[model samples]
Target: MNGKTSVVKHRFDIKLARSMFGAISFGMALTTSAFAFDPLLTHGAIPMSPAAPLFANTGSGVCVFDSMPTPLTLNEAIERALCNNPKTREAWAQVKIRAAEVGIGRAAYLPTVSAQWRGVRDETTTNVTNYPQYSSNYRNSVLRTESVTLNWVLYDFGGRAAALQNANSLLEAAQASQEAALDDAFGAVSKDFYSAQGARGAVDAQKEIVAAAQQTFDAAKARADKGVAPISDQLQAQTTLAQAQLDETKAEGELATAIGTLNGDMGMEPNTALAMPPVDAGVKPDAMFQETVDALIETAKASYPSIRAAQSQLDAAQAKVRQTRAEGLPKLQFVAEYSHNNQPTTLAVGIPQFPATGHEWYLGLQVTIPIFEGFVRNYQIREAHAQADYQHEVLREAQIKVASDVWSAYQTLQTATASLVSNEALIEISRKSYEVSGHRYEKGVGNILELLSGLQAYARARVSWIRAVNEWRSARLQLAAKIGRIPSR
Candidate 1:
């Protein structure tokens, strides 16, 4: 019984050990799997699937439209002018060139690397003599050699730094100049477009006047034929009609001239088919003189590119002076290079052969001290200082000019606004007077001469009204240009 008990105990111990070993193996397998998927695991766990891409897959396709070239709005015209005008495009190119110059200047702060190689061949003869013996001739041996080298300027007494600063300032100036050009172009185009509209409106008004005159003449002729009026009345009517026709012809010519001017401003062919926009007769000028003046001053301050350009030039000149002054100071730089050379040689009579392989490496520090350079540096510094002074004067001049322009435009706008009101009132009074005079003449209470006089006065008053309206329109556009907010289209 004791032996059976001992065997049972041994079997129980073996079963316990086997269970522990299986658990250990399972834990190791789990750890290994975790490590194997570490890249795809998050927060001590692995995802079962991949994440979706951020962008959606677009189907292959293209869109097309068939139509006549769309009519260009004012905004579109400005954009096209910027893109297509040769002068504007040239200015834009200049801006880019200056920007590249700035980059080049900035690059001076970084190290530069360069490489070079050279080869040479030579032959020579030599005579050798001992202390107490005759001289002996040695035949020349050919030598072939090659080498590579690298070099860097390292420092330039602060000249490079000053140059860089100047370049950056110039770039800024160029950008400002570009903006100024754009503003000028915008102003020019707007003025031309509005002027053309006014011209077309004037032509239409004149055509209507001509038609009215022709109808009056026809009625007068019919009355004379029926013996209801004198032949002189018909003659007077015909004379008025002829004058009206002449006026219409003049108006047509003026319209054509205005259109031509617009085409030139837009950089388009003079004969290009252009449709003039109808005038907005309902537009009223309501801003007070002081308010308009204040707005214009503000606009000039912020948007006048010429002023900004002058300021930029001033800044650049100052930078140049600073740079040149720096040139008179000391400079330091670090440099290093490695090279190898291989040469082949043949033995000559009684001459020993030399090894043909060579290698070399070097590291160095370079320093430059600016000494007297025949007063060249002095002259350069003086010139830069003068240029800086000149730029300041230019800036001052530009500011003054812009102020004058703004004030002039403001006054013109005010005058035009007032004139429009007066002209409109005069036109109304003249129309009433002419209508009364016509009724009196028709009833034979007023003479034909009085009727003709009233008609002429009425025509003159209408022409004045038209002229005033045009002036007002032009003045408003001028104000808009000064304020840099030409209405889009």
Candidate 2:
């Protein structure tokens, strides 16, 4: 009966030990699951930023182009550039980085919680030199400890607020800078698209000249065969035809180059082929340009992304100065900690070990006063002030530059608009002259030189007209961009 009782007691002790260990392990797991393993800590330990949606799937995979439009339009090209260009992606990344910084600054206002768990298998041996009877005693035990600590800054004399404000301002600056970058890309793609269309138009003009040259060559050859004209006339006509063909070939090459540039700007391979619709060169004058240049300048200064970015940078720098000043003041904090330890202890040799468990906890407020730190804080504050001053100048320079850009674009648009009328009239006059000279040569009344001269002049006039149309379109778009009216996204 006694043996059965001893066996029952041993089983009960084993069960009790297992329950204690399970309870401790379960408590530690709960602590970690509630704090350390929170979902917010999964994404690089940063809270989800408000800008997160804008940059979604950017890092998931690179953009793929399945099929291009049959005839890509200017708006489509701008959209592709904004979506796939490396420059836009880089700008988005900058915004994400700033957003993460803002999250970190906000985290400073929250309490920080940490948990620790430790277990050790310890073996000790003791020897008594004077008493051999008490020598060679050994003790074996297990030790377990668990702790959790929480610290929160209750007050910092505005240091945390300043830091958070600095972060917010920088985030604003990054967002504005991104807009500026996208607008620049939009303008670039628009110009390249128009330039490519112009090149195509040039090719068309060259084809017309080539046909006219061939007609002249055929007429001279027919007259020479009938002995009504000299062979030199036929030879000159043939030479003119060859020159016109060469010009056509050159124009085609220019068109190819322009298309390649447009492809590259759209974040595609340079050699990628793209079909583009012919640009409508009959753009009417916009009433927006009728406003005074000074008024436009004022509008741009008020809303231009570059100016806004500069202003935000200045605000961030000023906030940094305030943060630096606040860092030198005293801070108040709240701290709490809880700890537990369990181990086996033996008081003397030949005595069985006894299990001991202990727990400690404390909650209190802490005051941290900053004394002399080798004048580091003073220098930091000075540096911040200097930085603020520099940013102020940057804002001023941005305003000046925006004004200059508006003025230049406005003047360029006006010139391009005026040139369109002259170019159109020149084309008409040159075309009539070419036709008249061709008719006279066919009737054996005009020389080869007069016909060739008229042909060359007409071709030049056509090319000039194409250039004028492209310039007008480009100038208008640039002015709109300068006025901060271009939508990048």
Candidate 3:
């Protein structure tokens, strides 16, 4: 059990040591480089990017189209937007970062290992007065030692456990946040798409008005030639035709703007031309809102991503309270080490080599209890308590907002539906009036002004019908998102 009696044999091969050292140095030198990686030059970690090799669906090469091609179906448009949208990707990144935090929290339980290699040379010179004490005028010696050390936190009064739980809760919160971002993206894309469709519908209606105006102009010219109408009547018809054409041009411009906005929402180039059919053709399924507002609000409180995210944050804050409380408690740790020492023979001293390899271990319970911390530990506990309370309030607010959003969206849908019915009636009445006015003018019984009035009223009714359909569709998307049903589509 004594030191000298427990000597162990060891070998020191200087040649082998030199070669190993040279190899390691050479390898590290070869691996070193001046060039740095550029993230901007390559494809990044987009959540569902089309460029992602794991993705299966195809997109239009991120707005590579020089001109408008075939219209995209609703499903295709939603898929593309989900893939390329920046907000979705950003939320996805947050999830990943929080997941890494979970790993960091778990790491607190593991031991920290460190190794060191040290070599030293000592030289000294003495005068003749001390020549009898030291026969040599100069003395030199070399020593090399290597050691491996470890430190492990044996216990921490539940601090590590609380931290791990906090990390897990944060990760869940991040995941819920990601889902919320996706829901938001879906709502935005749907609104933009339907708005574009509405604009296209308006353009088509304007074209019909222009065609009717052309017909009126031809009839006026015919009557004037037959001496049944004055030249002023023909001029009036021509002016109507000119104004109708201008209206059609303006509608086309507005349609272009809406299409650009939709493309931007999809994370594509704004200038990319994307065409779509009229709103009627792309009308989504109109399911009636049979559920009461209370049921819908309850569903939102339970299932909405925002609500789930807030709940997760509250859990994380509670864990943080535990972690902070433990900070003022006692902790325990363990320490151990292994070492090797070599003293090689020197040509000048004619001394024999003395090299030894040994193992050393230190095992004990270490305790650390905080005494005076400038009230920092107390402040941390209080702050965590405050944060927990704040998170609870935030969760309540999130639920309230979810219910409010659902109610608002429901009201909007109802209003849009009622407006659709009223618009339909208006369109029917305006169509009949236009027909009667056309007949009267052809028979020389009504003036050009009355015919023009009927035409304008019909055009307005048609535009309103198109917008009402889009508004209702957009409202449905909003409600579905509020209730966490966006991915159902």
Candidate 4:
């Protein structure tokens, strides 16, 4: 029983050791995979952009999409633009390039490995002289060697660190630029989408004007036929009809143009058909616009992406200065090498033959101090300082522009909101005048000239109403963008 127990215990120990060994092997594989390297500039390279969660390509491109929603909403138009716009894609690509720069900066902290090989063949002859005799010897020899060497930077007095920091700051600036691009895209899509609706509204108004003109022409013609009006009046009425028809044609063309423009903004083919359903006609004041101009300016200074991007750029430029300054400092590195040499044989006249093989290993530290280089390092540092100063000025200018934009957008919004009330009243009064004039003409008590004048004024008022609504909508979007709320539905 004791011998059986011993054998069983030994088997259990073997099983435990095998399990632990397997686990260790698995962990080693994972660690090796973690260190695997790939090229950065090739299609075969592993992607590094995913390391940055904030800046990823979000577009779905132009090929894969369902039909644009019928009577598409403004929010949907902005979304479509975000997914399809080439400008947005270009900005995202810029971020990827900056991300690659980060990898390049990091590589300065790693080792460089290189290999070398050499082969040689030699023919030699030697003469030996004695008191009364001379002898000669000749030999042929082959030599070969192979070696691999490594150089690793162990310290750089913060040069590598500064470069890495600069790369990261540039990447962050690119991300902020992307956000600004998205803001512009949203504002553009909203403005054009609403403008298309305004065009449609103008077309409908022209249609009504055409009908009214036709009625006036018919009245004039009937009076002429009954010998109650002169032929010149009928001629004038026919001219008015022709003019009205021309206006209708122009209005229809404008509608088509607006549609094409909207499609282009949505990153579709220019001729793609788009349905722009009108929003509700009344203009309402947005409470967000109630802030004072100074307040709005302050808000924009904090929220605008342009300002943020400029700030990031300034930071990158400062980091660049640090990197340049450190370039003049000393560098320290560790180096290791292995060399092997083989030569079969060497012989000469009156001498012995020799065979040789040599192997060597070396490890050492190398230091590089920048003593002088035609003042190049100094110039580099100066150039970096200049760039940093320029970035600072740029950041200052951006802040001023942000404030100006917010102020202008707020003024536009206030003007548009105030005009809405007056515009609505104009539409009501003009509409009433048109109805009265048309009714009197039907009863034969209205002058045709006065009736035509009223018709023109009424049509103008309707068109003006559409323009007013456009201004109001556009101003709201512009203000929203200035306040960092442009993507709102």
Cα lDDT computed for each candidate against the true fold: 0.65, 0.81, 0.76, 0.75
Better of 1 and 4 by TM-score: 4
Q: How do the candidates rank by lDDT, highest first?
A: 2, 3, 4, 1
| RMSD in Å for model 1 | 22.5
Off by over 4 Å in 3: 1-69, 120-142, 343-359, 487-489
TM-score of each: 0.75, 0.84, 0.81, 0.78
Candidate 1: count of backbone clashes, pairs at least 3 residues apart or interchain: 1
Clashing pairs in 1: 162-323
Q: Who is ahead in TM-score, 2 or 3?
A: 2
List runs of model 2 lying over 4 Å from the truth.
1-66, 126-141, 279-285, 346-353, 487-489
Q: Poorest 10 consecutive residues of model 3 by lDDT? A: 1-10
- The candidate that wins on TM-score is 2
Q: Name the candidate that leads on lDDT.
A: 2
Question: Which lDDT tens digits does candidate 3 get at residues 1-489?
Answer: 111212223333344577578879976775663123322221132234422221224443532333334786655566577767888777877876786677778778889898877665534333223233322333234467778888899888899999989988998887788788878887888888888888888899889999999998999889889988888878988998999899999999999999898888777788887778667675554664668888888988998888899999999999999999987888888877888776443343223334444545566666788888899998999999999999999999998889899999878878887888788899999999999999999878998889888988888888888888888788888888788765334
Error of 3 at 55 (Å): 12
Give lDDT tens digits, candidate 4, residues 194-240. Answer: 78888888888888888888888988899889988777767877887
Is 1 or 3 the stronger prediction by TM-score?
3
lDDT of 3 at 155: 87
Write down the TM-score for model 2. 0.84
Which lDDT tens digits does candidate 2 get at residues 160-260? 99998998899888878877877777788889988998888888889988998898899889989999999998999999999999999999999999999
In angstroms, give how far residue 283 of model 2 lies from its true place: 4.0
